[model samples]
Target: MEAVALHISNGVLNGPVSAIYGVIALVALAYCVSRGRRDLDDRLAPMAGLVAAFIFAVQMLNFPVLPGVSGHLLGGAMAALLVGPWVGALCVSVVLIVQALVFADGGVTALGANVANMALLGTAVAYLLIALLLRVLPRTPTGLGITAFVSSVFAVLAASQGFVLQYALGGTTDLEHYSLGAIAGLMAGTHLLIGIGEGLIAAVTVVTVARTRPDLVYALRGLKRPQPATAQGVAA
Candidate 1:
């Protein structure tokens, strides 16, 4: 059997559910746009574009998990750590939109669920966790990397559950062979491994940027301590 595609396809969800989610996604994105403006400036605007591009590219590559299952990078935690949550959500949403429209990676009808899962819910959960972890974790590059790794794992998990919820609400499939519990279990198990891979990528990416341009990292702002003037001068 082939692995399930990372993107949701049309008809997996009922029409009413898909339409409802579409409206929800539109409202959420409108809110993101309002809030994202505050985070966008000369430096962050370019970084947001780059983050979106990187996410779009990486999401194309899927690695095997189980025999019939595969997973790809979600980029929620990575984006949230690099850019503010509002902008991060927008970045991921843009990637999903392009993938669905241009690449046909996800069904156009299922675009709402996809956006709600990977973009809004995943990014929000990751950013919140990152914020909480940063409060206690060391204010250093290593700490931020660790935080990203841990948060990415949960972000994927959370996004998986979002699918489960939608399916429960209005799944078009028969429930005789596959129970909701079974579906949830499979999604959670497969996505847990995928999350680990995502976490590693997020950790490495965040650490690299934090070391070089800490200023560009939204999560590091006000959290990362200023390096000693002499140390900065020497590094420069």
Candidate 2:
């Protein structure tokens, strides 16, 4: 069986660290449920469902980056861009929970760490990055696409850093075999390539949705209306 390094394995994190992450993840999930309830109206139901399903499927297909390392779509950033941040976090959390419980894709005990890194950090960072980018960039489809691409990379990179932090604290993995610096370096570096793939996929998806169903794109919702045509142009 090929070993995967991204998801923290069971017993890799000590009880204290795991408990801490569990508490944090639970708090975030509660908040997400509260927020998602309001956001998941009939209008958003189909889009949200589709986005969650797509993310789940994409995450299953991992691309190899190195000898033992592989990376998959985190999907938090893309979900946030499509839905709102809170609901986006919730969407990814659902996938992580199901993957952990049903598929045993991630460590059962490490569910909290996985959710915290992939769902909370990814969605929150992506939301902040998008907001910051939108202030400077024009509010057009092209501009939104650029924002999605950049945010996706940054969000996944941020999540990768979160993993490094977890590994630094009470991690039972090859920490004794390898230095913290080495672990951080490898995690961040590989995720950089993963982020590139994430950015491209997110950008293309956002552009396609903007072109086809602009109304469903939450990121582009508040764009300013174009100026009205002058009387001469209207007459002509």
Score every model by TM-score: 0.92, 0.89
Model 1 error, position 52 (Å): 0.2
Q: What's the true lDDT of residue 16 in model 2?
A: 89
Candidates in order: C-alpha RMSD to true structure: 2.8, 4.1
What's the lDDT for all of these models?
Answer: 0.89, 0.83
lDDT of 1 by residue, 1-236 (tens): 54335689999999999999999999999999999998899989999999999998888778887796778999999999999899999999999999888877789999999999999999989988998998887757878889999999999999999999999999998789888999999899999999998999899988888888887889867346565454431133
Which one wins on TM-score? 1
Model 1: pairs clashing at backbone N, Cα or C within 3 Å: none
- What 10-residue stretch in candidate 2 is worst by lDDT? 227-236
Candidate 2 has which clashing residue pairs, if any?
A: none
